[model samples]
Target chain A: MSSDPNSTSNAAAKPADGLNDVHTLSLVVRDRPGVLVRIALVFARRGYNIGSLAVSPGAAGGFARMTITSQGNPETLEQIIKQLAKLVDVVHVADHLEHPPLEAEIALVKVGVGEGSDRNQALHEVALEFNAVVVDRGKATSVLRLIGSRDELQAALSALAPFQVQELVRSGSVVMDKGRSVLTDLLQKS
Target chain B: MKASVDTGAQRLIRFLEHAGVEYIFGLSGGAAMPIFDALVDSRIKLILTRHEQGATHMADGYARATGKPGVVLVTSGPGATNTVTGLLTALMDSVPVLVLTGQTPTFNLGKDAFQEADVTGITYPVVKHSYLITSAQELPRVVKEAWHVLTTGRPGPVLVDLPKDVTQGPCDAPEPETIDIPGYRIPSLPDTEALDRAATALGQAKRPLLYVGHGAVISGAGEAIAALSDKLQAPVVNTLLGKGAVDETGPLHLGMLGMHGTAYANKAVVACDLIMSIGGRWDDRITGKVDAFCTDAVRLHVDIDAAEFDKTVTSHIQLLGDARRTVEALLPRVRPGDTGAWLAQCQAWREQFPLTFESPDDDHLRAQHVLSRLNALTEGKALMTTDVGQHQMWAAQFCLTRANRMWLSSGGAGTMGYGFPAAIGAQFARPDTPVWAIVGDGGYQMTLCELATACVHKLPVKVLIINNNYLGMVRQWQELFFENRLSGVDLEGNPDFVKLAEAYGAKALRISHPSEIDDVLSEAIAYADGPCVVEASVVKEDNVFPMIPAGAAVSEMLIERPTEKLEKPSGST
Candidate 1:
């Protein structure tokens, strides 16, 4: 299941409360073999439920950044952060619950309008309202690509539901700070 | 080429020799042939074990005994899989052990080649850090990094998986001048502000208690703990693994608190107003009911691992640093509280409920009696290691230890089959010291294969097997909590251990009566030419007392067996 977009909005969640509240943790780690497995094992060992995980090469060489959405007790999450920081390959771990980071997700949806111009025109207006672009068009089906916050993507999907949505695929949330500060800045000081 | 270059295996051996490693406990197999051959010309002696698990336990024992990183080298697949238990054992106790396992050639890594296994994937959860080496040039750096990670702050096990092709390939890489591990940091002195607060809490405390754990032993904080105890006029209690961190013979010391601990130690924990924990996590065994464990006490926790703070039980003051350094820093800042009445109350409890057992007027001997006699004979001078069981708890109660590292047991992991092999490792670490392995009948059978290793090396390790023909600890639980419905606790058709040890070329003796304990133990101890075995046939169903039932509060401890018999569930026999 995709992570709930509303969980990160509430910064005042108490420790050991709301076991199902999703948490977003960003980790900067060394680009070494088995680093991903090492990081994943830390979550699995603690029985924390990971909703979605994304990893990509870092801006600098010999490094990688990972975004993980998991749900567990906040107290246990604090211990999990400490355990992650203990890993030799893990450089930094930042939880986005306190200061919600700038996050976005992209989704592609294919809808069938049933060979009617009126329904096709209605789908186009719905796409326009949600700022989605038509990526492909067929006689009775059309594909639309949407990029926005998780809530926006949900609204767009619901708006297109009347047109017989055939398929949908989504890229998990990617995040960054609102300012110029980089996570790797901590690396230089250490 | 100007000259013949060294293979990766040869270079690894050379690096280990340069690192001052004296022994490598390993079992050789197909994929590990190159490394085994490379050791032919090296100064580090290799102790071949009967099983890979035995080899790992031996290395763990050596590390615990000497405070040096114990090294192990083994083959792929089963060899690598078997070391998982030993690695977890060391990891749970914060012991430093470096394991080197051979893998299939790089091309056959994920293809499921013969004798191939995903070494790093299999061991990631248990190890502190691991490496899967694909190229020969990475050996120097990996070896240095693994050693550094294993022996540094919050020491634990580290693994290096070397593919066969990588080790067989040629290498000429130079050793790095410095270890560049940026993410790995060793905590220095703790903040003075936290120390000041902890000292103030101690100053205000009327009934203070010093709770010692393995961290105190690891950081050599025993002298400081004693100084703090005397300065505050506070009584001291140790966790199971924390037994030898401070001298148990001292009057201020209450030996081993928690489940199966002394009643007086648990009583002191209940009465103390402030509890200062040094190097010991608030494990479930010690804090039986966390909410009720010293609820009124002001908690001060000092440890090197920051993750342990507020993990199970929240503390008011957290000092994150080496235990010795933090305690030493707090010494001058602390003001002694007036604890004369508190100390007298604890001493009265100690006198009222001292650790004792019934010397029954019968033919059968008791495990507690055997251990108490052993303690008297050794005079708390021997290095004692025990496997997990009722015998282990009895040994912890009766066999007093005098210094750090003097008593080693599988505390956190509760691993059976750990004692004999660990005794072999300890004997190697301290060749002149008296090494003893106090084991149960069940656990001794798990690692008795190592008897050959001890005999071959002529190591003077004494193995005392408390043979009661049952898995004593499990049977005790079934009898107490399960209406005496004994299921798989019986060990029927067991081989005679005396004959078994003799078959392995060890001097073996069997003693069944209490009167024979001193003579049999003296005979075994005097037989110093090689390893000796003494199988004491003890009472079959005796259980360890002063027990706090699992998940029960410390106040709910059963100081003795229930006087009434439990009613068995109705069934047709």
Candidate 2:
């Protein structure tokens, strides 16, 4: 008797600080057309808004690794993961925050250097403090790259806000458990 | 064995025979001619359905009626798309079906050739797994592995998309082997620690409810569930598909517990302090509002699918294993006690708010009354297949099936036109058992062409079309919620169903008066020779009660209208 799930629960419980309660999900899914859309539909159908999403070819061929950051109640997110795992195309799903997993995000900060101005030197200092690489040093701009946790990247971006930051791009956090096992080895052998 | 042919299609037939696929329901098309040729020599019987959707539903019916997997063969394009609803039905209900679809020639791959569909791509989300055959030699291994996946833990439909060229190539694939899919895992054994937790919960509760779902049927754990419930003396509420998991007539059984379920069943769900959900997902229909469903209950769910727990109602203890194994393991581990006061309260609710329908004063009969009388006559011994509508709900509420594998319907997809063909499949699967399809006027018209298939096969199955000249369920909804501005629900121009049945050469009967049900059913159903159809023109605007509207909590169930019986016509039955 389970029908259209748009109304899964009456008015999903959204905490006062729900927008800030970010959850990270890792998914291994079959690489096929509309696979991403299908996975997104699972989350969207559950009324969870995506904070950020990143997908890359997985370690195993013919599969993709998807990292999703969303803000919702842990209960609802757990339900969403269960729904996702129910999909045949989804190989494995994990909540990184529930376990000890390695998480990283890379960002590029191109600040307007103003042709050898003090801002360029200050940006260099900030890059050194945050272990960011000076990827490019053009006449009018200095593009610095930062690879760190979401919080660290946010702090670095805040630090570079003083300089005239021209353009900024960040890859959403990608996560995997910090252990000897992989999703395929764990899920397949379960 | 004599030297046999090595053609891919022939080898596939041999594999299906080896897997004990006795019946294959399908419709032939351009891409699958070789397999049809091979089937001429195969041992399996082919049930050529009037439509591909009916074929899939029939397979679904067969699989649900029997514990074994059902097999289906269809060609590509629309033949495959027509299967979507049926596949979704099986996938949602976790019934095992193997769908073999013949794809366009491999060389025509992405050219959108005649009757080509990306079957694998389209069905990825609905199937347990699907494979587009890339090698002719791998056909045997694919068949073996597909069987394993189809029948294993948390069983669901699996699709094997066969390219036509592969059917023409030589099948020199290695002999079948035991399933060794590295990524697939059977559910874990009954967790003793989890059982210990559940036992403690069950031991402490004063108001415990045993809620059985289709998982009990899937695991063949009806006896175990009944034994557990008997020992605890807890009231049992079945989900729609869980009707037969516990005999509906059992003293402790509180018939289905959801929308349009018995009032007592819905009341028990909200009032019970402890709810042990067995093999049920607590779907939105079951749990009207997830947060408020069993607000005060200490929840424990035993499901083969681990994904069920916390997905809807968060459980305190989750037994992640097969229902049979889990129930068997916990039978001795828990302390035996009865919910005396709690049981009394439930009994009070059951007694005070029993299911009832007013005796209309008109000559036209009430649909539910007919279903109830059928139950009385058959003693709930017949296997029932129902199409979705008011009739399906009435059947769920009235049909008193006494055992598992006797109630089959399109529970998940709620597909119309599913009952007649499914009745065909169920009768074929269980030749000795009486199979009756309880369908509505609107749904019956969708697949009435199948009456010929039934007559041709000479299967002794009875079909009761509850004729109200409208899509009763939708009409009821519109009447209640849409201020009676009924839109597309009317079917006043429906063909005379009895005449239609006679046209197909099946025994037919038409009953309009309330007094004719018993005689007509007894003569045509119990004593019928082959296929039979009974079209009963039921009272119009008759609504199914005990409904929990969408997005409402179970506690807020709309039991009955204030003037519902006041408007009943004069001739009381």
Candidate 3:
């Protein structure tokens, strides 16, 4: 359901620890049709579950950047990195985890405020505590939207226990490693 | 890019042109402005989309249309994140797409950076491979590697994350190399021992059922599969994905099996002594509850993916390699079995639950009639790309799929709006093949903008829009499930699709009368100068019968319109 390959695999096999052990990498490519299929086929063919992903284009016309998280030992990540480096559209690749970066995801969880005004208030209070928002409210249920780190959302979900969880949807994780130098430096002397 | 002077942006565009990339689809964003500026005078065409998801889907459409790797470019953060759904669609459907995203500065990597999303991590599982360029110098080599990974193996999405600084950084334009994957290659031949055991199994079986799946289609082994089916005197049952692997008109053909499959096909599979599955995984939809599936059959599973064999259905014999090669090797070894009893049982079931469509009396646009007319018009020379919906099922059922590699539909992904773009891809792959995109109203609107792509490329793909005024599949479900609650399925106001086609600079034709189908289709197909759209607005309430209401077993299917209803169908009566 979620496009995140690692999430599906992780859900199927809950690694006792978390996904931090996984290797993460990113790249820039020309944005074109079926690019995702090309990427997925590589991972699927090799039986690798991508942990997280975010993609966007560059300031110029033809290229875009894509970041991928994969759960594997160093050797597997090396193989993936090497493989990714070989695509014609790929312009660059890096290990963001090695660089240390800020990462987060947004999730919208719809819950049933069953049987009382207190249950509704409780759900709203939890959202407020997490700095979340109520994206939509309906007669039967209220949808609470949260944007935060996976840890934060998980904490928020745990806190909102009384209301029966109706549906859970999440935006794929996005990241940028922190530093002072802007990406535009290569094009212009800052 | 000049030999002596190559900006990071120019280097990226030049790399794309060298890789044979024809077009780029995405919106201009803050992080991507420098790259767009570089592409202003480049050979690679840039197409801006309404949204990032649309950009990816457009690229997916292009890939499906051209069989060339589709390319997408989006900015970091929101632009990057919006691509998940499109990436997911391509991933599920097996489209080769290359997605590129821009990031903030490398130094601003982890401090909750602005417009910063880890495109690689989020897409890791969804894509075949992904990368974040730590250094600008590595761009050229990485680009080459992305292509190799995309086209070589089972093609899917690949992503590359470019830090803004890195995209703009100067580096020697590295020479592109013919990248060789050390450990990734599609094996051509199965292990000799595995083939030997498979041949032995073929030699012994009294009644073998050739259960073909999408792998046969993927491996381009449909003809070989049919030949082997004949050599073994086996009835071939196809999964939904494997619809045209073996000709449906052939005597040995048993239609389809699994969810939405024929009753006789399911019975034949269940009752067979040996079921040799080529490229099928015995997915839950096809097998129902695995324990209760093909109980009597000794399954001979052949697949390129070794993990698929015996992963679900128990395999008596397994062949791991190309389906055509495996089947061809076993063809000489397999001897005809005295399957009179087995064939008779299969025939009996077929007679009991035969696939039929009533020839519509009122000149009303009938789905089956249109398909049959299209079949007659093309004479099995065309390729069919169907969007997943009621029309897809109808097209699969009614169309005469005699040629190998003629059927193209989203089997694994069941994606809508897939037909038009995918048809373009299929046509591009084999330019000689006349490709028809059979899409329903709802599905056509999903990726309708691909019309421009087709026109721009001068692809003369015929578009057959089966307009039923609703999301036919979901409506069918509502009719079956919620007793026609019809919530969220119906379209409130639909555009005149025929005129809409003309607006896109395409030839448009509409066939409302049953009698007009032949003439309209001929004229549409005859138009070779540009793309064409033929809207067949069928009678609104028509239901695709042989309906297996969701969760009901294959046997509990409605084979035909009820006797009372059929008998009372004449308006005069």
Candidate 4:
């Protein structure tokens, strides 16, 4: 998330990557009062800082899904999943990292396009190729909106910056596991 | 009673109102709309803000003003993310705030639903505590818990994330009960032995200094700090947060100590044989160089948070308890001491570095001149609000705070634009007190939108805008460090503040000359049926002096007033 070198730098520099006995669990629970609290309190009372959490309402009546990503070993993660499922409004709890899923965060990167269209056109073409939106445009900078994997967004940003770059804002990571039935099954359970 | 089957969201709002929350500042979106829907006809008034940042600062202002928990609500994802800055302000200032945010629906969980963000995870380090309400039935208990967490212990902001489904779900409101809070509870009194040890140390010292912080104000122990100082004949020094801990005009009061601290207060702290720290953690700003700070003194630290002990400075006697209770308990053991020479030394230091402005009295209106007039006008009844930078330090240095809880400003965070919202909060807290939000040109713009809230609320707060057309603090830095290569710091085009106030339906007064200061101040105070704005155009080059020069030790502060030299100028302007 942050360019704070402490966490990311350590992860990037280390070549030895054997999962680290860690797994990311993404759970979808019905968006209701205290549902997030119940899930979080369970983790908190057990002394766990959730790795990530993303939540939004579904297209149905009286149901929203909160995607909770937490770090633990297989056994602990399984226990948490089981406990989360037991929650009154929590419809489903699954580990999204290991399973097939759609994962990406939206980033609005403000890139400076030099003097004119040569740089702007090149960047605009690249954005079109990548299906990105130009949310903000100005003489000095254009905020190109990109929604994709962290790696992909970073790659695009690096490539787009042959011209001067101004500012960047990433809409933190949001993930949806593969298959249409996930939302349905969770809503039905609710 | 023809009652509706209320959802978890309604129950939460009901609990909030039951807890005596009159207002909730926030924005409504998908995950949290159910709560907003429930709030439509409720007793609690909701001020819909343009942005989450606005709500957070509004709540921040409300809390700083009222001495009660400020309440804010926002939708999940961007809504929750937007409030991070405000939460940090509350955390740093030790102001209690309750943030109610909507989370994405449970069914859409982890599937990366639209507008979903990890609120609790992101806010964990920043807040005192955070709660995510899962069950509709548990809404009452969760809200009650949040209020309790926000008010008790070292006060700070607490987050309650309510999912939309949970808000709409049908359930009976759960009764409030004491659930085991693992490690936190309102702490008991300090150990008798620790109290005795501290009292003994205080009794023997030749010169003792009592340092207080915002914790005193939060614990309702401002009187106790003053009492303890008087009882022991010890001079009082305050952290920026502890401005009104002792009446600014009272005897045995040196003044605020920190980076921009008075020279006397810093010297008193450094020269003291016994340093009794109450309600504050002797932070780096106060201590300067930790190793050398008060080397001759035996330190006594008392606070509710035990972790603060020995985290920075070594403490000979550490007491963990409420400031009021601890001071009360230690009173019987304390005996008066005489240190004429020590007092003389402290007064010498104070006279050496008096905070004086360099502005000529011939014409131009200076910020300090306004502060002086403000002090005289209010006669210490005014609740002074200060934004960060030259204006904030100036207000703290010059304002004669006579009443307890009269000075409100963000100290630990030193947030710019905080003065406006904080003044709004303080006015909300004490509606009768003459609240003034003193701000510089730069900081005034940060939460300028809150002026509308004050006008709407009909709060009779007087806004004193010290317009200098520059980020005066940053420009001051450029003058000293960058050799005056000022860029981006200059704010040339500013809105017509007087007209802006009129647009918001408030009385406006503009003062461009020194002659108009007294008249405008009196006029603003008298015309304050609702709210009023007084813009005083000050010189941009004016610099607040007797500075610690950033990384300098507390003892090494510039001992002479630079402004005095500017005023004298070695013979006439």
Question: Which candidate number maximizes DockQ?
Answer: 1
Give the per-residue lDDT of model 1 (tens digit) for B175-261.
877997767889968887888988998999999999999999998899999998888788899998998888999989999999999
State each model's TM-score restricted to chain B.
Answer: 0.98, 0.96, 0.86, 0.94
For model 1, the DockQ equals 0.28
TM-score against truth, every candidate: 0.95, 0.89, 0.69, 0.73
Residues B17-136, candidate 4: write the lDDT tens digits.
888898888788988888899999799988876667768877887887677788998999999998988898888878788898898887876677899887877786567777776767
The CAPRI-style docking tier of model 3 reads incorrect
Q: After superposition, how far is residue B279 of candidate 2 from its true place, in Å?
A: 1.5
Tens digits of per-residue lDDT, candidate 1, A1-190, equal 1112223211111354667777888988888988888777778887877778889988877788888898788877888888999999988888888788899889999998666778878988998999999999987778999999877998999999988888999887888888755584764554
- Model 1 spans > 4 angstroms off: A1-15, A180-184, A187-190, B1-3, B564-573
Regions more than 4 Å wrong, model 2: A1-19, A26-41, A47-68, A84-92, A98-100, A107-146, A152-172, A176-190, B1-5, B176-178, B360-362, B526-528, B563-573
Pairs of colliding residues, candidate 2 = B361-B569, B361-B570, B361-B571
Candidate 2: tens digits of C-alpha lDDT, residues B1-573: 124647778888988898889999999998888898899998899999888888888898899999889889999899988898888888998999889999997899889998888887778668877778866888888788888889888989999988888886787767865755543557856567889988887888888899988998888888998988888888899998887988888888888988889999999998887899888888777888666777667778898876776665666777889998899898898886668988888889989998988875457599988999999888777999999989999989988778999999887778899898888889989999999999999988888888877888899999999999999888887787667789998887889888888988999998888888889999876655789999889988898988887767789787886344222111111
Residue B563 in model 4: shift from native, Å? 12
Candidate 3 local Cα displacement, residue B356, angstroms: 1.3
TM-score of 2: 0.89
DockQ of each: 0.28, 0.20, 0.02, 0.02
TM-score of 4: 0.73
* Lowest lDDT 10-residue stretch of candidate 2 chain B: B564-573
